[model samples]
Target: MQSSSFLAAILFFISAAFASDSVHKYQPDDAVDLWVNKVGPFRNPQETYNYYSLPFCHPSGDAAHKRRGLGEVLGGNELIDSQIDIKFQKPVGKTTICEIELDEAQVMQFKEAIDRDYLFEFFMDDLPLWGYVGDFHSKRKGDNQHMLFTHKSITVKYNKNHIIEVRLTQQNPKPLEVGRKLDMTYSVRWIPTNITFARRFDVYLDYPFFESQIHWFSIYNSLMMMFLAGLVSTILMRTLRNDYAKYAREDDDLETLERDASEESGWKLVHGDVFRTPFSIALLSALVGTGAQLAMLILLVILFAPVGMLYIGRGAIVTTFIVCYAFTSFISGYVSGGMYSQHGGKNWIKSMILTASLFPFMCFGIGFILNTVAIFYGSLAAIPFGTMVVVFVIWAFVSFPLALLGSVVGRNWSGAPNNPCRIKTIPRPIPEKNWYLKPSVVSIVGGLLPFGSVSIEMYFVFTSFWNYRVYYTYGFMLLIFLILLIVTVCVTIIGTYFLLNVENYHWQWTSFCSAASTSVYVFLYSIYYYCMKTTMSGFFQTSFYFGHTLMFCLGLGILCGATGYLGSNLFVRRIYRNIKCD
Candidate 1:
């Protein structure tokens, strides 16, 4: 038995050595370049030329394409040397071999996409081909040693004229998982590669129904807005007419006047302190200013998206956003500082600083955490250190200073008006509120109408961001945005009216919070989408996704809150100024 065991071990060792020799580890003398073409969905059955290549794995050909200028790309002009060339191609008879290394995070991303069975259609020189990435496999060579690699095959055929046609076919559709290695290696090959494809291109349109759905949603949202607006207008007119009529009937008898004063009810009673500066006016102003800036930013981006001006490059929208935000810093400062001064605030500088930095700080802090995680995971998605430094410089010098300048100008530009109502020296006792009338209840309920107006459209936006679907329906988005604003204003006004009728003078913050609650629903919907719709896994993707979502929700909150406050402010001022109060 011992002799037999020794012979078996020796035989196993020899076999292991032979098996290991068959597969050699790849070593490239120069940088390995992989070309990633435009990614599209399989369901879209068009000719597939409309998809633009992603810039992450840009090749030498892109440089030449950009040199032709934006007009050539945007104006439907001639194709300007945009095809990526495969320089490493060998003789048609010999199999071409190359090693591609992917970071662990990237592998995880690919795995997530593949696990969902997303078929990305690829285009080469206008020839459309489709494929899905498969699982990573490890084969035991011998002696407990294993070789790891992912396999994919692309078949090509050559005609009599040597014109080549490439066909993409799935070899093994196994689910992929990230291994222990920080970088995963894959061996790719073109099997039976007859030869190259002669240059010919065609344009294909897909997702035709996507545009139609946007139009339908826009109309639905507009109808909802109109309903809410009409309801609020009717209620406000009736209530205001009654209040004015009652006030118009003067009670000249001193005893009757005293009784009426003692029994005073409705908004007229709180007129003395309704416009009194809310607690922490600085923070309130800052929020309003930030909200205004974000609202404008969103509107401008939506307007420009369909025009193809903002999406110039892979990161061009981000760059445009940053630059525009910096320039728009003045709007935040001016709005916040002006409103604060008008409300008799003393700390204009504090309000301005908070206006400029509060939202940005939240965004940066979350981004830093996400970027750090990406870096630790060896993901190329992380922003480079130098780029972060440049961003800081721009924020500090450009955005911050412009905000300060705007604040100074606003503070100096004085045209103070006498307050519509005189504040009483002693504070009136607030009545005990019912459970349903509490601020918390009001806020949650007030957000519903506004949220409902955009909920359907929000799904598409989320899917576009995470599911990698191309979104190009800005016209519909713009209409939805307007409808959302309308709903927010009308709902907030109704809520403010109720609070005032109850003699609650603290409508300033409540008005903002109530409308801003739409963001809360938005965040909740995002959580639901992540749990139910997406196949994304891994700690890095989760953290990045939530962090960004939080920032987005916060921006939405700001925009809605600001819109509510401005609308309420106008309504309150106009009504109070017109009323005759003794």
Candidate 2:
């Protein structure tokens, strides 16, 4: 009975979520809801505030608000019901909404909003419409006047019973004055259209920009780079094979053996120290584990988004990401635990804790700072206290426990040390090499190719996020992602081989950093993009833009770092496997 009740509850929850998003068929004279969403400056996309934050006329009594999902709240949406009475297929002529007695305070507010170029957003039957608050004009030299729009004209187009489009036009501009009596009025017109509801969002998609020749050319260039990276890897493998044959030849005379030993001063000389536990093994393991989880999470989201039409919903992407991250916490713990154990680490508790909280705590710290900024500015971007608590509960109860369970399972299953070479009792002293051969240099240079491979795609992704463009090309994104991974692995492998060739055994962190440095270049490019492409000004929008970009870079860094390390590990083991180790 308890199990049955639980299943029923789950089903009801799912149904409720889907039901709110389902299309509605309206009968003639049935009331349609107009939802007032948010208002913000035209230049700043993320800096939004509640619709009622401005001195707009409110409903006489208590107003109804729409309940939003987890994603919607995170995306900074607060939808309030606009009590404009309208019926389906019923056209209403100019009707007075309210009389706003403009006092000094209201005049000041209107002037400020006009100066900032604020725009209001409304939703009717799930279709969105936008209109500016007011405009400013110069009647003569040194004589400027601020005008407020007092009339709203809404045109709704429908096919049969389904609303297909909604448009808003602001009219009746009245000069702002201290004792002005401005009448707020609205008119609604219902028109029949042959367009279907499914094709309504097509108007918002910029197909020419997304599918241009430049975009396809970029993809082709990335593909060519991938093949080049593959060629480099194949060459490295062949060279390693030749070394293996020479080192494994037992019939060589003592004189020949001695000559060969004298000549072999590169990677072959460091076999004994190659498998030694790296410095800060626990932190490295945790980061790698987190990266693995992010890699899988991004792949899953990209695959699921197009298939499910996740773009149609307001906050569906964020909601899906949070839920998927929770479920995939197991992957983080599993990878961290196995890596820690394999490296002979004894602090199981520390490893588990770090694996679970590292990335999340970093994000939370950044979010806390950004949220404070939002709150100070009275922006709707500030996450509410209740939403924060809900996220915490989900992480604590669901993500943490799953991580713990995965750690235990991983420790028992794949924690055995299986290095191809044994660690020496004492570490070999790393000889100084040329400045160009240094780990720092190699790490920096290693990321160049990988960054180049995905640089074009990054521009598209950034524009879509910050410039109000819908990104529907997950297929292009997936291909670019795969190319990035391949290039990162191939480049890091080459870097690791060079480090080892210099008789350095600290290839682990070096390899990771080599690939992870791609994020540094990406962050720098974001700075350039911000300066050149966007006209956003003010502290709030600036902080949010760079803060979010930092978060993205951190995740990308971790993902690439982990992939590099894993690839290098395979390469190191393969090359050493056939060679005789002392």
Candidate 3:
């Protein structure tokens, strides 16, 4: 009976191999070497709470089919179906392999196909989405790992037989010549895969989409980050709550006195005080802040600049930093001035400078290390030293002035604005109680959870970006998007409940504390990712990496939990600050 079963299994395997058919067979059309395509202005895409336009569609403009995306895909509900034709011809008896490539001296340029422009569409189909990142570092269908923003699970599976070549153009960062011209560059080259899959090159169009066109690695990274971030926050916040509470309210003379004198805003009531912020929370905020600035910068540039749509890839990281930091400084100065004034952190000027310079220092240091490493390795795509200098000059000369202007404008508006609620100044201290956590503390804690929920995703993200991989998976990302929104909402609700339960009588102070905890978790996970995953070196390298990383975490934390924190704070301050209870 065993021998008969084995024979049947062998027969099934033989039949299955012959029955598979996913890839078609045909040779690539002629590969163009030189094409002078005209470029055009890009328009902006609509903004929504639960959506963002794909990079290929940003700055919404017309251009050559190279240099990035000439014909950008327009609006769609999350993921829409997309396709790329792959044609290849190997000797009937032999196999051919394929790989993704991103090596050249200049950017690829091309022309747009007016209205017939269906660049690519994806149908999200219930997958959660975060965001999309396209780096030309990976050119092979297989053989490449997710570099900076990808997941660990990136193995593509399909029935192999024939082949087709899906080609596109490449060019230089427009208006900057002195480099080689990019032609109809195949997004993926079947070379390394040639070695891996016996010279078989199944082609791939490197775009992040959902539905039938999802990439496994990209999806995994997004989901993983949120999971890790949430898990870590939950453990620390739940297990270490009492410890943090004591640390915040303990009889430490220094913390008590400092909290009394140097602070004024309701922060004195926040989860203890700034110093009481768990060492882990502080660190995460610092790191996630950097990523926040980066995200904001990219979004702004894409929304404002003429060429941002086509130029928002690869070399644009520096450009993003310049613009984001400039704009962020204004926000920092304005918000800090108001919050610190409310908190009673005297010296608004000092706070402004601190906010403005904080990210700048981080950017310079990291850029320095990355630039050095690129020089040492002789990577062709390395941002040039001259370009670096130019970028610095641009930031200082162009962006700095703009930031200064915005700060002044913000300061004026802050003063001019009417307080929605009247301020009452008097010695009204709350009676001692263990029920309600402080509002500042609550918000901060709440912020930390969202951060934790997303940290696990970073493991794959950093690896994808560092190792140089193409993370094109819209389906999984769409799923992630939904999950992220739901999880964020759930975590916020859970945190708020725990806080209200602890101090049902003092819901105000405890409200904000819950949200701020997520930021704390984000910082903790970053440390974990750094210590356990990344091989980055040097103080500058580590500091800069941490700084920008925190920026993203911080932004996400705030954006996700803003409604709860502010609403709770207003309720508390209005109802309790000057309540007529005698």
Candidate 4:
């Protein structure tokens, strides 16, 4: 019965999610509802507050509010019915909404909002309309005056019965002064259009900007890099084959073999030490596992987004991401457990705990800081306590248990060590090499190609998130992601080979860091983007921008690091498999 009840609940949620996307058809003279969504400064996209937060006239007695979905609520949307009367095909002209008696406090509030360039958002038939709260005027005396717009003109376009577009214009600006009687008025006009409902969102998409020549050129450049990487891999494979032939020859006499052994000065000499356990094996395993899970999570989202049209809904992407991350926690635990065991780690509990909590705790810490800032500023960006509790419950009940189960299964199934060569009891001392051959140098230089592969796409992504541009190019994103993975793997393998050639057995962390350094370049590029592209100001906006970028870079680092380490691991194993350790 319990299992049945759980299944029913899952089905109900799925149905609800899909139901939100259902098309709405209307009849003539049907009542139309206007929803007041949010208000915020135009410069900062994430800094938002409830529409009713300002000193505006409230609806009389038990105003109706829209019931939001999980994603909508998480997105800081608190939509309330504006209680304005309208008909689907009918128009209303020059109607008064309310009369406001502007006292000292009301005048001050309007002045502050106007100074900040605040804008309000309203929704009619799921179509959005934005208008400024007020305006600032400069006099000949060089003094600025704040003025409030007391009139709203709404124009709605429709195709047959479906709403295609909604526009709002604010007018009738009056100086903000005490003892003023301000009359708030509104007018609604309905126009017919030939546009289909499917194409209603076309106006919001910046096609020319997204599909610019530079975007295509970046894809071409990445393709060229991939070809170069493939060439490098071919050359490396040939060299390894020659080395194997020389080392595996059985016809050579004892003296000849001894001479060859003495002459062997490269990667072959470090075979026994290459597979030795790395420092903090538990932590490394946990990071790699978490990275694997994140990689899979991103891939799944990219695949699902286009089909589901996730971009059309408010906060849908974030909701999908959270759900996918929870379910995918099992992958992290399995990978971490198997890796830790293979490294001969004894404390399974520590590995499991780290694997489960490392990424979550990191995000929570960052979120705590951001949330505190939001609360202090009284912005809607601050997540509510109820929402936080729901997230926690999902993680604790669903994610944690699945991860624990996966760890136990992985330990039992694939935990045994399978290194090509046996580890020696005595540790091998790494000799001094050229400055370029040093691990630090290799790690820093190795990330250049990988960063170049995805830098162009990063601009588009940043614009979508920060500049309020709608992102509908999931196909392009999918291609860039594949290119990044390929480039990271090839670059890290080459870096690992160089490290081994210098008789360095500690290539494990070096390879990971080599690929992970791509995030450093990305973060630096974000700083450039913030300065050159955006007009955003104030301490709150700056903190949120850097904080969010930091979190993104950390995830990207983990994903790239894991991809590089796994690829290098395969290369090392395959090369050593043919040559005898004995």
- Scored by lDDT, the top model is 2
Clashes of each: 0, 0, 149, 0
Tell me the tens digit of each residue's lDDT in model 3 across 386-470: 5556656766775555545444555556534233333334323444434335445555655544454445445545544443333
Q: Which pairs of residues collide in model 1?
A: none
Question: How far out, in Å, is residue 45 in model 3?
Answer: 32
lDDT of each: 0.65, 0.89, 0.38, 0.88
Model 1, global lDDT = 0.65
| Per-residue C-alpha lDDT of model 4 across residues 1-582, encoded as one tens digit per residue | 999999999998775443332344567777778889999888988789988888887888888888777778767788898998878778999999999999998888888888888988888777778999998788999998898998999998988878888889999998888998999999989999999998898888899988999888879978888888889988988888787776666324657777676555778889899999999999999989898999999999999998898887778899999999999999999998898899999999988988888998898999899999989998888888988999899889988887787778788788999999988889888889999999999999988999999988899999999988889999999999999999999999999998998899899999999999999999999999999999888888988999899999999999999999989998899888877886
Order the candidate numbers by TM-score, best to worst. Answer: 2, 4, 1, 3
- Per-residue error (Å), model 3, residue 230: 16
- Which whole-number lDDT from 0 to 100 does residue 92 have in model 2? 90
User: For residue 413, what is the lDDT in candidate 4?
Assistant: 88
Stretches of candidate 3 off by over 4 Å are 1-313, 316-330, 340-346, 369-385, 416-464, 471-582
Which digits, one per residue and each the tens of the lDDT, describe model 1 over residues 447-535?
98888888888878887767645566677788888888888888888888888888888889999999999999999999999888876
**Best by TM-score, which number?**
2
lDDT score for candidate 3 against the true structure: 0.38
List the lowest-lDDT window of 10 residues for candidate 1: 23-32
> Each model's RMSD to truth, in Å?
15.2, 3.8, 20.0, 4.5
Could you estimate the TM-score for every candidate?
Answer: 0.72, 0.94, 0.42, 0.93
